[model samples]
Target: MTNAEPLFDPSLPGLADDPYPHYARLRRTDPVYEHPAGYWMVSRHDDATAVLRAPRMSVNEKNLAGAPADDSAPPPELPPAMVEATNVMNLSLLDVDPPDHTRLRSLVTKAFTPRAVAALEPVVTELVNEGLDRIADGGRVNLMDELAFPVPFAVISHMLGTPPADSDRIRELTGRIHRSPELLDEAELIEGMAAIEELVKISREMIDWKRANPADDLLTALIAAEHEGDKLTADELVAQVLLLYAAGHETTVSLIGGGVVALLQNPDQLDLLRRRPELAENAVEEFLRYDPPIQQTRRITTGPYPLRGKEIPGGSLVMVAIAAANRDEDHFGEDAGKLRIDRADARQHVSFGAGAHHCFGSALARMEARIAIGGLVDRFPSLELAGDVVWSDRVELRSAKVVPITV
Candidate 1:
């Protein structure tokens, strides 16, 4: 199970169900392992963190081995229009480099500040209570469908000024577009393009509507952002809005669902959380460390670089296994495999990433998880797993396809 032994294949089935064991073995044997895909696989905490924070590593796929430097270049092996569509939709701060990333992130950071996110605590509490109220008397409940999926969407929709009626549609589009790259084939890519186009139209309509009559929501703030006496262009506005919708919702959904599955598997941890409800905040941290929403993140070496005594050539693709890093015994002790709700060092995990490109909506996400999980336990003190849990096939975004529970 060493990293040199091919612990698990990204293309394999059922690997998502339990990747931690493999991750542990990799960290122990090969902290900086080379993969057959012509990239370095960083599986240890210190090594992964160093790579993520390294200036030589770039988030832009263009710096990668197979991607074009610009959108105008001939499309990659993707279907005729897939590459173009993806390039257009991926204009978020996540994909951009420093200056532009700094600019885009600054605009949205104002809305996601600690004060702003803290203010949403009450709103999040109410939203979670309402969702749990509907399912408290349920015979069987799919937590993903009934709770985990909707609460964050509702919160983001409120923040973005999207109508409540459109939440489900927007959620479906975001899910399809961000769930997994493997699920996206030629046809699915086209559908994803259409989804983004529809979302852009929706964003434009909202922008115009907000311009006519504004509110204190994030949308209004985004519409008001100006730099060097220049406001966001129509296309930039659409891209920014799409980024928030997808990232703000999908990742939080995965967090809640994955957290629940982890707690269920470790009833001792769940019981500890139940007994010391005040530990909810720290428990959320443990959840992120124990089973992060994002399993792996890809970057490219901007120049020939040496890591762990091996040379990674310029334009080499590098996959940082965040899940593996979180489980690294070097940082979290040998018992890192066990879930400790009150683990003081849990906050050191890179679940929300690190560096300038760290997750912009992290505060809001933590708020949502704390409220949702706390509210659930408060409402149904006897909650337990009602059926077998099922993880999604997404290798990049680790999440459950279905999570059933009973009270």
Candidate 2:
């Protein structure tokens, strides 16, 4: 399990079912591990936090110093259709560094501010109640479809003022494109690339329509958002809107779905939450820490990064295991593995990440989860698992694909 023994492969079977045990072993034996996949996996909470918060850490994939100037033929050019898609990917908020990252973030940061997100509480509550009503007669209903997906999807769609008619297609495309970041073979990568191209096309059409018809929504705000006499270029607007529209709801879907699954599996905590509904906010934090929506995030080293006694070389890819860090025994003590709704320091989890690249939709996601999950708990006093849970294959955005439940 330690770095000295052999290179580790994080894509081992059954990891999605439970990664904490593997993460625990890595934290104990090789807190800072260099994986054979040309990346470093940092499992400890302290190391993960340091790497995430480090100013030198980068998110740009171009920072990876590829094999020294190979004399082989240059790589083939991307298809014309893919060029636009690739450009959109390059301009993504998750892939850019500062100045660009700062600019892009500042342009829309106000929309996600706590005050702005608070204004959506009534909207979120209404959506949550509506979802509950849909599942009121439920006996073995799929929470993922009934509550998790619809709530966030509706919320983000409303925020973006996107056409509700296209939601089904958008969800499918987003799911396919999101698989690009996970462990994939050649065929899967090609499929993901195609998905990205499709999403970009769809997004462009949406943006074009939004322009002709402006509304008091996030998409309109992004369309008009400017900073320092700078406005988003047409392509930049498409990129940001696509990012916001896609990423905005994906994580919240995980949060609500995963949060519900956690409670169903931990009866005591569920009972406690039922008894003390006031702990809803703290319960959301605990859910994030116990089983984060995002399991890992990555950064590239701009310079030698030291952790424990090892020094990761410059230009190396570093995968910060946020899920592992959240459960680090040294950080959370012996009960780190257990879920406690009232865990005082649960908010300290790096689930939303740290530093400049922290998730932009955090406040919105929190509000959605708090309301969606809390409302469900309140509505169903006798809720229980109807069958075994089935988790999504996605490695980063962890969530149960299906949580069969009875109310």
Candidate 3:
């Protein structure tokens, strides 16, 4: 279809630059495509939403047919240290099933609820203003480094009560770790695993420090969190902290980075947002709908799944294309491909996903984006794209590595 064999291939030319066209083609020709890679790709909005909403759809790889019962066990070829690092990740909310997901999610669920996130509004505003202040006197600066990454990164770090000095190292390691799902070669996979190992070490050290220096922060609360006298194990703590540290900012980075680029590209929308900063809230949802950070999320079907009239075999790895679904014409209307900050149904987009496994940090991410993006627009009326947008090589975690801008 569209002359792009195995449309899921990340190495395809210009894919990182613009994937929406291909996604549109897939949605048109094959809404429920079974990829040659032994995975299924659901492109239509309805199908994607249905797959994500299905309670039986499993997030854990071990649920797949013929998969190892103990999915944490590494093959003989992989290094033991690598396996150990991945095992820690295996305990995170992103890679678990119902009971464990329910338990782990419930533990910290209150921390990120809308009301709790609202309490952090003052802190988020301060962080956003500080980030904007840094870029105010700038001529040309990479927004990714200056505003986009730092604001969310600072927010997450502040919440976690992590040592500020260790952030650069954490950023580097997390960048590497986020590349794991990019269909890596053996060597690349090994490198990613190594990064995970180092990050796990850092997380453990941080957790221990938090134990000694307990404070009124999310990290301390996590350390103290207990459900029916059952606390998160040491490994689970490491996994969760790492997940929060990485995801807490990374997705929002994409939001701010990609959103700004979209606005700059569409001058009309930029003008509208600048004139009416109140649209910032709606703009955040539009940004997510237009160009979502996490493009696709996967679900391992525990039983035969019917999607768009086809029966996908049990244990199938089905990719729910969130980005594509966000732009589905049937769902969002004919101009779904276009960016409209005022779109009434913007929040209806499945960018944060749906059902049980919806993103826990959605409230926080939205708050940060609203403040940060709104602050940027309000402060810099003449903010212009000064140079090319350097897109990240990541397919799943879609974001620009650099977005040079001048205010």
Tell me the whole-model lDDT of each prediction, alpha carbons only.
0.80, 0.83, 0.85
Q: Which candidate wins on TM-score?
A: 3
**Which digits, one per residue and each the tens of the lDDT, describe model 3 over residues 93-152?**
999887988989998776787788888899988888888888986767889888898888
Residue-level lDDT tens digits of model 2 in 120-223: 89989988898899889665699998889998988878888977547777778778766525478867776777778888888888887888899998888877
**What RMSD, rounded to one decimal, does every model reach?**
3.0, 2.9, 2.1
Which candidate model has the greater lDDT, 1 or 2? 2
Candidate 1 lDDT, tens digit per residue, 197-232?
667666667767777777878888777773234656
Better of 1 and 3 by lDDT: 3
Winning model by lDDT:
3
lDDT of 3 at 210: 87
Model 3 stretches with alpha carbons more than 4 Å out: 1-4, 72-74, 180-182, 226-229
Candidate 1: pairs in clash: none
Model 1 poorest 10 in a row by lDDT: 1-10
